[model samples]
Target chain A: MLSEFRNPISFARRSTANRRTVALIAGLVATLALAGCHKKVKAAPPPPPPAPSAPAPTASITATPDTITVGQSTVLSWHTTDATSASIEGLGPVPTSGTRTVSPTESTDFNLTATGDGGTANATAHVTVNTAPAAPMAESNLTEQQFEENVKPVFFDFDSYSIRPDAQSVVAQDASFLNQHPNVNVVIGGYCDDRGSIEYNLALGENRANAAKQALVNAGVSPNRLRTVSYGKEKQFCTEENESCWQQNRRAQFTMDQ
Target chain B: MMNGKKQPLYLLLLVCFLLLVITPALRAQDWVHTGTNLGVQHIRVAVASFKPLNNNAQTLPLKSIFDQTLFNDLKNAGIFDMVSPSMIPPEMPGSPSEIHLNLWSAAPANAAMVVFGNIAANNGQITVQGFLFDAKNPTTPQILGKQYSDLANDEATRMIAHRFADEIISRLGGGINGICETHIYFVSNRTGHKEIWVMDYDGQDAHQITHLGDVALSPRVSPDNTRIAFSALGRDGWAIRMYSLTLHRLVYFRAPVGNSFSPAWTSDGTKLAFSASGPSGNNEIYTIGANGGDLHRITAFRGPDVSPVWNPKTNSQIAWVSGRTGLPQIYIMNSDGSGIQRMTDGGYAVSPSWSPSGQFLAFAWNRHYGPGVLGGQDIYVMDIASKRWIEVTHGAGNNDFPSWSPDTRHIVFQRDNQIWTMLSDGTDQQQLTHIGQNIMPNWSWK
Candidate 1:
């Protein structure tokens, strides 16, 4: 035991002499430990908690009136409140739900509703009973799509007997609508842009108006439903500059034939 | 020294590990069309459509014409990963089925969307039905909103299809927006002389934009669609003039020493790119302010460089048809007229319309390739990036001067005396005008 104690004392003296070696080891070990700890901390930030589940939206329907006068629709609209998924059925087909389509029958109750979100609303439409409402006094108003389908037909291309496709739909749709509405007689007034000679545009405009009337007859509309007139490029919708105004002026208009 | 070695080694290893961890997050698929993870980088479009009926068997009816027009319109819109028609399945011989979501899915359209349609005619009337299938949502295929038009026996099926193409774009929440409605401004020889006329994008509701009856030609629509700049053969000579459609006003630019023709508008609507031949004695590219101030000549060349089309997005480069190469070919140079690179090698490529994406150009060239009117001119399009050229109009009639729609989906030009529109891919060439002669269709931008 006395010898061991003397040896340890000598070892302590040697360690003191080799203090740089110990310090170097200590520094290296400290760095390794710090790096390892840093990596662990970096990996510890956990992922966020999952979102709370939500219920699907519900669909519902509403009508202004349960019953409407004869020859009138009840104007019912379907609304979905909270249901996630909803579809309407039994209007035209199982797939025709949520779309606006006129009913074919005269006196049937429209059973329609949208279902989605978390809740549903229902609407019952009672179409009014009436003899084909004696063709109301002639009015010459038309919708945007109607302008494309009916009024575009009368204008002729330059020096050619050919008609372009974009304008044909306007003629076809107008003729079809005229056929459907017997009392509403219309005049197709053809106009031209400022591009051509006034007389040339007038003749072209007349050709266009005549073309629309011809299409109406072909589409099964009575001749009494339409007449023709020409206003070659005289009136302008966009009369300010270039093609923008020219396009608007080169059109056929529908007016009530009183 | 030994401890020092260990520390350096450890430091190096830690640095290597950090690099390894950071690399993957930096390189991920970030170029997505926003709102969806399934990004479509390429789209292929092919139509197997119904053929035309020949009431008069005397003339051979061309069946593929309408299909070509529709294809062209959709391709020009720049939304699809269009596939060529050759790659499409054989078209059904008769009526087509309502687009099935399953077929689109089975085809695995490179794009998550597909358009399929049918055209039928009887007794001088026509019907076209089309559908847009969202391959991403296979359960519901939207019946592309449509309008049924009645056409005469003489009307071409090709034009009807262009309208249908426009409808397809409108359904996608683009193209037919109010401002995008088609417009044409042209110098018409109708009133015993030439005058400027403007009309809807489809040639309806035409009105005079300029009452100046002096052979107005080469009308260009401003980027905002509110103004137009045109050159008229005035009493003095040719005059470059500006007119506002919204304000109904006209302003004349400083007439260069001689004449100015073929005016093009910069995207900002503040500048005009045109051709002016002055004391310089050569037709060179020049720029002037929208309000008629600050005239700057861009190209100082010996040859005639006319019809300058400025890209709407970058506005740094202008693509125009130049005779600098001895023969007319398409060329692109800095808006300042530097670093010019010739784009086309083919013969007589004129009237270059730079599409909104700036990746495709539509021009008219007379090809001696296949059948029909050998040496007659037709319009063609080239993909600037892929260098793929697709012929748009085929056969006898001359299809020239194509102006791309603002949405870049449709190109309107004149074939014969009437205006027509089609897709950028050389499909669906449809006529838009009927009475009187119309030409020089300039489409508006929203």
Candidate 2:
């Protein structure tokens, strides 16, 4: 049925029909005015107007701000005087008269259609989203290998989670990085020197990780952005029996994730 | 020849002397090994070289393997004083027709018992016939005669000899069946990563069982000799994994989210107990059915509890290590987590292995160890009846994870980087695995 109606007619016919209706309405108004003068009518709650032949439904949409920077939102408002159901093309059905906040990634045209006893009416609202310059460091999940490299391990004294005087500076540096890249979260892994039971090492590792995470928070990193997991003695960075190797294992490590 | 009365007295004196001499000989004939005497002195035995019945190219080689394996088994039985082959006469006898017990009991080879066997290798198969005899009482019946046939290979030959040797040990070395046929499961890192491996009790035919390219540790072979329970690191963190020895595959266990490891099985092979990091941040002991269901938490101490071992005799008691006392110590509790008792007073102790008889627990402890103490790790055996204990490995490199043999007379443990076995009394320490860093050995139940 829609295909039978040719193109250019939908817009042209609507305009032409609207003009002819206005002229007829002007003539009707003159006649009505004369009747009012003759009858001295007391405007008794005027009888309701007759239903239109094709239920002339109406719709309108407007974007509060036609364009927005990426990640910013824009409010779209729509109102239809005579319509039962109304929906926007890009969005599903919405109330006949209301407003909605939209955050589109690109320029998009939203067509609102209202249908009721009246025929359908359409309107469009264009929302343009501009991409903000790429975040200095794009927010992406770190690869396991990348995590291994970017996160510098923090060493501890023998059987100690207390940050050494020298180690304090290292942690502060880590805090600085975290502050700059607030979008990245980190898991602070605790470790041991492989001298205790695997279970004991696990708890000790937890203490170390918690200690490092606390230090980070103390240095102004968000606590929720840091996670703590104790590897215990299960994973080792060194295998030698010397103090050097043992020192390497007795520490907390920083690993990042998106 | 003299006076009549005097001649009668002389005849009675002569008859009494002969009767006294012959009675002891008759008693000696009836004295045989009935598996009753379990004395300190070793039972001397002789193993004659097997007769090669056919020239199947493998007959000579197989015979040599059988002879050596059987001889070593008896010698290692600890109850035997084996006669050296060089001491036996050059004449080799395999069957009953070719044997003479008198020769074994002779001067140089004073073996109280003798074992002789025959070997025959036919198309891709070999048959071994073994016979044990009492050399002391030649007129007595044969002690044991076993016939075994299998694929004609070095492995089959050694296995055949082990079976024959076990039968002899059972008949002559007391009531316990020798562990010649048993295998010990352990963790080896020679393959670059720790893997579960199996080897004969003597460390022969060592083969990798689980190729789980990760660090698999604390291997405990089940009672039925069909499965192994070990802990490995995986995507789920540390999990207690089960490997089917019979099916030669990994079986699933009802795993917990926290760090789970160190699985132990009940004597009846129906339950497994393990340690997992509990929600409270401390590792606690938990138990589940063998088929991987019906979980029950057995311990909820403030400190870490791990390495559970079930009493093989009662199947009602479990021994494990708990860190509730600051340092890790051994503890025992009933199957339902009742009747909790502390076994070790102080110092670091771990890896408790309950004896098959349910009489003792073999474990590694560092009693005199302190912050800087080196070479303090030693294996100890404590009788449950009395809190008394004896050290097994001393001054040896950090011994741990001692497992009891099926006979309950021997213990296999890890010393430093190798697997070693010794008598329950800590006498004859023999290294089982040498090429790889092996640890956490668990003797099979059978």
* Interface Cα RMSD in Å, per prediction: 32.9, 24.0
> Highest DockQ among the candidates is held by which one?
2
What would the per-residue lDDT of candidate 2 be over residues B16-91, giving only the tens digit for each residue?
9999998776444421321212457888888899899988888998888888999989888878888988899677
Q: Please, what is the whole-model Cα lDDT of each candidate in the order they appear?
A: 0.60, 0.80
Mind giving the per-residue lDDT tens digits that candidate 1 earns over B340-386?
88887545567788888777888887533221123556777777766
Output the number of the lDDT-best candidate: 2
Per-structure clash totals for the candidates: 98, 1
TM-score of chain A of 1: 0.40
Q: Model 1 over residues A25-139: C-alpha lDDT tens digits? A: 9999999999999999989964542325444444445445544444455554665444333444455322213435343235556665544433455555555445454344323
Candidate 2 reference-contact recovery: 0.04
